[model samples]
Target chain A: MTTGVRRRLGVEERRQQLIGVALELFSRRSPDEVSIDEIASAAGISRPLVYHYFPGKLSLYEAALQRAADDLAARFVEPHEGPLGARLLRVMGRYFDFVDEHGPGFSALMRGGPAVPAGGTYAMSTVSTTNALIDSVRQAAYVQILSHLGVTDPPARLELVVRSWISLAESTALIWLDGRRIPRAELESQLVHDFAALASVSAAYDEEMGALLRRVFKEEPADGPFADLAGRLLTLAT
Target chain B: MTTGVRRRLGVEERRQQLIGVALELFSRRSPDEVSIDEIASAAGISRPLVYHYFPGKLSLYEAALQRAADDLAARFVEPHEGPLGARLLRVMGRYFDFVDEHGPGFSALMRGGPAVPAGGTYAMSTVSTTNALIDSVRQAAYVQILSHLGVTDPPARLELVVRSWISLAESTALIWLDGRRIPRAELESQLVHDFAALASVSAAYDEEMGALLRRVFKEEPADGPFADLAGRLLTLAT
Candidate 1:
């Protein structure tokens, strides 16, 4: 109110600004602690404008969750080029960045609870639908990850394996954040190594696992994440 | 009034029976849906007796969670015999058993939410605490796994890798339960391989990893869970 003339923002710009402000605030505090007024003030707009964009606090929170999920999901989406190991390393780097920025929000959503919302987009369901919310977000994220792993059309078993890897990454990321006991690069490499081991084991039954392993090995740089994996996997195949 | 014989049981047996009844009840539905009167009836006792043991519904829920966590943690503690891969497979078998018998209960605790109690044992904190519950359960179990792997005292980095592997197992178990798409044997073998792969990566930095890899290969039977691993590791060392 005191600041004389506010710069006019386009609908999209205003919507984005409001969501960004709300995201930052909610990242620090729960949805209940955040107020429409705070979001408006943060963006140099009025409370009504905030309401116009989000309708209510729950709606605002859902938009933020969608934005955060989209941002995190986007990290796993890299160009479908390069050796699988290098692509994974790059994706993990972006993942670490997201974990660092939204530690609380990420855990809250991942844990599946009442603190988050399920508005029209992200969590839009009532209390009974929390599982659905978690399932949708998790499944969608895994589809992207399995694709990056070159199992774009993952068989049910291969897809399960990739989903397991994703869960392991989530656990490792949380631990890594708390106890920087291990170097970031080492942690990333460890994950890549685990996936390699899974692929090797998967070969015992599924020809697809064997073929995928061969492709990754052929595509991998001679001296990169796959170097150590090479001797282990290559020896096993023969 | 219903039964002619009112059998008197010891305090501990009665308490155990009550917990078992409550667990069976809650395992089917979320904690919110179960009531004290029903739990008492299921145990063939009065509501006052149930209250006498648990004081309230929250206390009963907390006891069940601690029991489930202990039960799952207990699975990781097989007799420390046999090769590491065999030991892991055994433990994973027990883990899958826990996941199957107490699917929803295991998931509810693992997800870390308001539905469970934090009375004295676990998940009794804020969003930050959610990570702690996961970390606590994970570290405790990994300690056993590391012990079985001949890492009686795991170094900081190896410990981190084990934590990551445990996370992967948790994720795989969750996915496996949701979709019986993957065979139980396949899932177990994949986890064993992931740990083996992590060991190889660690060998690059630590002498212990090298020594253990040597031991696992040396002690491995002519034919066992890690036959595939032996081909790769043995060939590489030569």
Candidate 2:
């Protein structure tokens, strides 16, 4: 150890420095392409110093990933009390902004696997966090839409809505990232419109589907105003 | 060269053999995990002979991918003059059937992109082919839906329906692949129901949004429908 080198930084400062340097390197290269040696060299510290702060490269990566994930989770959850559409729009905006600002980190996370053996657990943990985030967002959006629609009961209904919305959002984001032929603005507009439509349509249809389904099971669809509709639904199923 | 030791095969037979062997390897490991050397050895041929049939590893992977893609496209594009819902069901059934039958090949294609960078151009081409097939299936489904609705006009309307429907299908499939939480039968049922709802809602909302937008441009209605809608949309703008 060179006695001339300063080593008086607090634990928090050292941890933060290591993460900041690691994130920069990780963003620039895939996990396999980056090494702890490179991280220590870039940070102007000894490899053992880096090891003292984190158990290993994998542990460092996992800590960094959890920090980034926590940031995203904070933006998407809670404060769910606004008008249904408004709240969802806010979450979506935050989501897209996060990806745009941090394209490299977002890309690695979205790509959903490790590029190195040391990164495998970190990569998988991030994926699990993402899935949970998606599920939570879906639920928030579903509750908002159902409240707007005035549907109080029917356990399966809200789950259906949330799953469907998540499906739409995730798929759109995946295709959009590939830089396909579609103009970016139009792609964004399309998603917004679809979300609005999904909410509005469920409001109208669920009521009808519920009533019609109940009657068809009774062998007694002989009376409701939408009796003909019920008959046709069964016919289509057959 | 002992004649008995090296039996010669024609170009077509050799190409087919190479694809079969590559696909087998892909089944065991994803495209990125498999090597050209393994493929050549498994096919009982020299490394150069494998290249003789296919330009490179990427081309061989693409060829194998294209075969499965073609089968899926054929099923999706197959004609059926029927009700919108029925036709969509048939197409959806075909899609799930294709995935079930060729789980590995479908998974590889669905997990699109040249994992090991034979280059981005190959990925771009694969994306285009995939987008085209998706578009085709979507148009067929749209035509059926519009026929059911008894609407025929300026082509833009049909294009809108097709685009939305394609997005719906693409999202549904991705979610289904990612989430094995739901039983297959239940997933299929929910898919049909949700898509039908989406199609109906999208149609109605488009018309409503278009009219409201026109009024905002022209007269700006008192306590206008778009007043709060703007703030809600601004939430989307970030």
**Which candidate tops TM-score?**
1
Give the alpha carbon lDDT tens digit for every residue of B76-146 in model 1. 78897777678878888887888888777666656545354323222223333444555567767977876
Point to the candidate with the largest DockQ.
Answer: 1
Error of 1 at B226 (Å): 3.7
Give the poorly placed runs of model 1, Cα more than 4 Å off: A1-15, A25-60, A107-137, A146-153, A215-224, A232-238, B1-5, B8-13, B28-37, B46-56, B111-136, B149-153, B205-208, B211-224, B232-238
Clashing pairs in 2: none
Model 1's number of clashes is 3
* Shift of residue B200 alpha carbon in model 2, Å: 9.9
Worst 10 residues of 1 chain A by lDDT: A117-126
Query: What's the fnat for candidate 1, on a 0 to 1 scale?
Result: 0.41
DockQ of each: 0.28, 0.08
lDDT of 1 by residue, A106-143 (tens): 65555545464222222224333444555566677677
lDDT of 2 by residue, B1-238 (tens): 1113257788898788778778767654557677788888888788887887887886787677656555656676645453344555566787777656655444554443335333332333443444455445456655555544445652443344444456565555555565444455544544554454443333333564344223322342223322222232223222
